[model samples]
Target chain A: MAHDTIIAALKAKFAELVTTEFRDNFRVVVAPARLFDVLQSLKDEHGFNMLFELTAADYLKYPKATDRFGVVYGLLNMATGVRIFVKTWLNEPDLTLPSAFPLWKGADWLEREVYDMYGILFDGHPDLRRILMPEAFTSFPLRKDYPLRGRGERHNFAVITRAES
Target chain B: MPLEALPTLPEGPEKDYLWTLNFGPQHPATHTTLRLILTLDGETVVTAVPDIGFLHSGFEKLGEDLDFNQYVTIVDRMNYISPIMNEIAWHHTVEKLMGIELTPRCKYIRTILGELARISDHLLCAGAQALDLGAFTAFLYGFQQREVIYDIYETISGQRFHPSYTRVGGLLFDVTDQFIRKVRNFVKEFPKTHADMCRLLNRNRIFLERTQGIGVLSKELAIDLSCTGPLARSSGVVRDLRKDEPYLAYPDFQTAFKVVCAAEGDCYARYIVRMEEMIESLKIIDAAIENLPAGAVNVDVESKAVFPAQTSVYRSIESMIQHFELVMPNRQWTPPVDEVYGAIESPNGELGFYIVSDGTGVAYRARTRPPSYIHFAVFPYLIEGHQISDVVAVLGSLNIIAAELDR
Candidate 1:
């Protein structure tokens, strides 16, 4: 069945928001500039209260990729059990986008994870530092270009001998 | 009142006395591998900063390198307490991506195992919660039953810990009648131990003192923070993916079970919710075993996503060729070049897998929405204004599996 209510609400409320074909759930693609506004609207008006998941997909090597990274925001309306994906594409070099932390408090760690893995920077994130990776590590491991077997940086750490301490 | 609303120490000479205490990447109460920097004013916590990623094995990055089948082994370590749930969640998403339907027997068998995994996980959480609260006997009561569930898993998959039995289309092997008989016996006898645990802890004054009104999370905060499964249910969020989304064979056992909840949202309430959930899981397992269908467990032979039987390979050339192609790299099925997000109601919460496919056996990007990763964030909010001792209570209540965080 076509999810006309949500589409109508989005079109009626925010005419500029671009929504794509409904697949597994309602999929919306909005510009990076309008992300904060759209997310706020979804949270306040549409009752998509929970930003349950936030992750970026590195589509650099994929033939069908339109952008270098696709940051997927998995939204859910708690009462209704409705889910939607709000996606914003970011190209290489300047991997900057508006952070959803201000909208949903749960987005704090998620945005940090996206930044840690994909090297995507979130603007206005309070503490957007490395979450899963070390703060000193330079390269983003989840990026398509990054090697699976990391570049032997661990070998540099001095091995602790019995007498070293 | 929720713990966060309590008065913070206003600025003055008193601010200098605020003790900065490091609570475990190795400490006992933390259950290891999760560190929390607690700013304390005497016994009451002022602000808590979480530092995780100690067990960071790079599982998600491994997903891209490992094809669909190889990835199951990685998911096992993510939520190591209940690996079968991870396996089911992984294959469930993969099947959704591949548009493969499981047979009736496969569905029923998965439902039984999934509920068993839920019970097994809840038992650990309950045991750990009691163990952390100084109730050693209660811990043993719940923990000993977990071994029986492990025995059940071993009967099916030949492994006690990380079964990794689930495959993309069906399973590693079809469960025998012996497996069904074992499951039947488990559900029958599990409740006696369940009652013993409930009688020991539910009314015990010390257990109530340690847990009740401690680590309180409000219903609004619970929903806003996207907490699910027992954590949200304990806070009166009343949202369970099993009831609402109804993936697997949960809908079939609708009359037999329910979404357990509690209004308290404290450590005690979380424990109670878990305790009640185990019973509900037993009800699901019992109902499923009773009405278990008799048929081939795997999908039709035409489906390429599943591993073929060895005898079938010996009997037919097509089976041998299919097995060879599936085992070999870059010679197997090609799923659609699309993205799909699918989640199951794991023992903790909404354990989800988001797979972005490039129309290859290997996923372009495989991300997991681990419940622990998000639930751990709520800790700083919950533990503030509560005593340092309540930290363990809160952490145990949330069941923050540290292995899930790094992924």
Candidate 2:
């Protein structure tokens, strides 16, 4: 089957669930609330059995950005080799999305990573502890609000002094 | 306080008991500072808790600060051993998101270089695995070939480990015929060296006894944990990103290779899979070189997708402004604000780039789905019933590099 036909079938199947469609590359952006069910349906009915990736986005510079944070999921069909992108937008104040760990076991670490960097909460994740950062890390460094140099020269000097002591 | 006078409780029978031991966070066999606190019943392991994050560098956060062009260097640092593959995977992903297709020549060059990286990675893993199993001679032999491959990499990228050779739109520069000739020579000689290494370890009774049925991961467990690259392939999983989803010159090349798997799904299977993969990678490099195309290495200067050259910026004020705006740390180059998850078959399984572009010059979120991280998650499970000595052997066979895992 052609890539376009597969996408067309998906659009037809989940037309009601999706808010916007980026048809050129088979990406469908659904509302955050409906993302979990949509993903479950895609996996059970549509055969996108492999949850390839689950990552987050910080949209600090977009004009039509309804929410400042967006979470993206990539699913793949092992048999057919077709990839589908599912996206859901999250409001800046509370960056939380429904967890997909129950559906795909691989989402365990991926969700933890999203939580670690973007400070997004994966509701219902069994062990959603920080995967890549120190336990005492105070801030989500991936957030746009966090400066690259971090609290500036004073923080660096303080850290150096503390280390020496 | 004499023990004989103080307490004399009558004992009917003395029992021989097993003791538990913890290895790692500093053990040489854990490979990459992974702390595996193990509860051992004497030599056999009862339970293992793999505590990671000893090498986390917060690569995801670093991506937010660096521009699209500079971010390739960051990805290059993820899997330091196979830096070229990481950089190329990220490059292809960014190019896909921006909808900029490179010239055929660039695609061929990437294919060749990626194959070379695969060979180097497999050699390192194979050698390291042998070393962990007490086959020191095999390790030296593997490193001998790896050193030659590194020299080839240095000639192309000018960096020993982290080359950052792959650019967002294309390669850093074009490869000369001399480099191609050297690669061809390496291809011809690599098979004999590989055969010698295999003879040194493959059928050795000691190596087989140590690895054959150790750390067995069934096909179902492998799939559940989402193991990629050699780990998944060894368990009879037919999922190669290059073969399944062709991105660069992989589709153009015509090559035949088997996905090596063992029904046993043990540490031995993983070792065989990697050793066989090195041979297959050599085949791919040969095919890519034979069918190498001739054209401009990068897209034209007028292409709006890639950042324009400095000469174009100097000649045209509009170009200068666009370049400056695109490269600015604060101002991001918008590229449709969509998200793309591009994966390539790296030497260590599926190295995927889950890029969330908010239509900005800087990636909103660049998440690397490294295979090593997933393999590490299942490490404790694999080592549960194994002995303390076999823990090092099992960990070495998994080939978990801390940089990629913690990144």
Candidate with maximal lDDT: 1
Off by over 4 Å in 2: A1-16, A19-25, A31-33, A60-62, A92-98, A152-165, B1-21, B305-334
Top-TM-score candidate index = 1
lDDT of 2 at B294: 88
Candidate 1 lDDT over A70-108, as tens digits, reads 888989987677888888888867789988877888989
Q: After best superposition, candidate 2 residue B300: deviation in angstroms?
A: 1.7
Q: What's the lDDT for all of these models?
A: 0.86, 0.78
Please, what are the lDDT tens digits per residue for candidate 2 over residues B1-407?
11221222333454234443556678767776787666666678777766677888778778866777798888888888888999888888888788888899899888888988888888888888889889898888888888888888888878877888877677777888877888988998899889999999989999999999998888777776777778877877877777777779888654645556566778999899888888877877888888788887878756655567668888999888767766676664567776666778888888887776766787777778888888888787788878888988889888899989998
How many clashing residue pairs appear in each of the predictions shown?
0, 7
lDDT by residue (A22-63, candidate 2, tens digit) is 423467778877788788888887788777777776767555
lDDT value, residue B70 of candidate 2: 91
How does each model score on TM-score? 0.96, 0.88
| CAPRI docking class of candidate 1 | medium
Scoring each candidate complex against the real one, what DockQ results?
Answer: 0.56, 0.32
- Expressed between 0 and 1, the share of native interface contacts present in candidate 1 is 0.71
- Shift of residue B401 alpha carbon in model 2, Å: 1.3
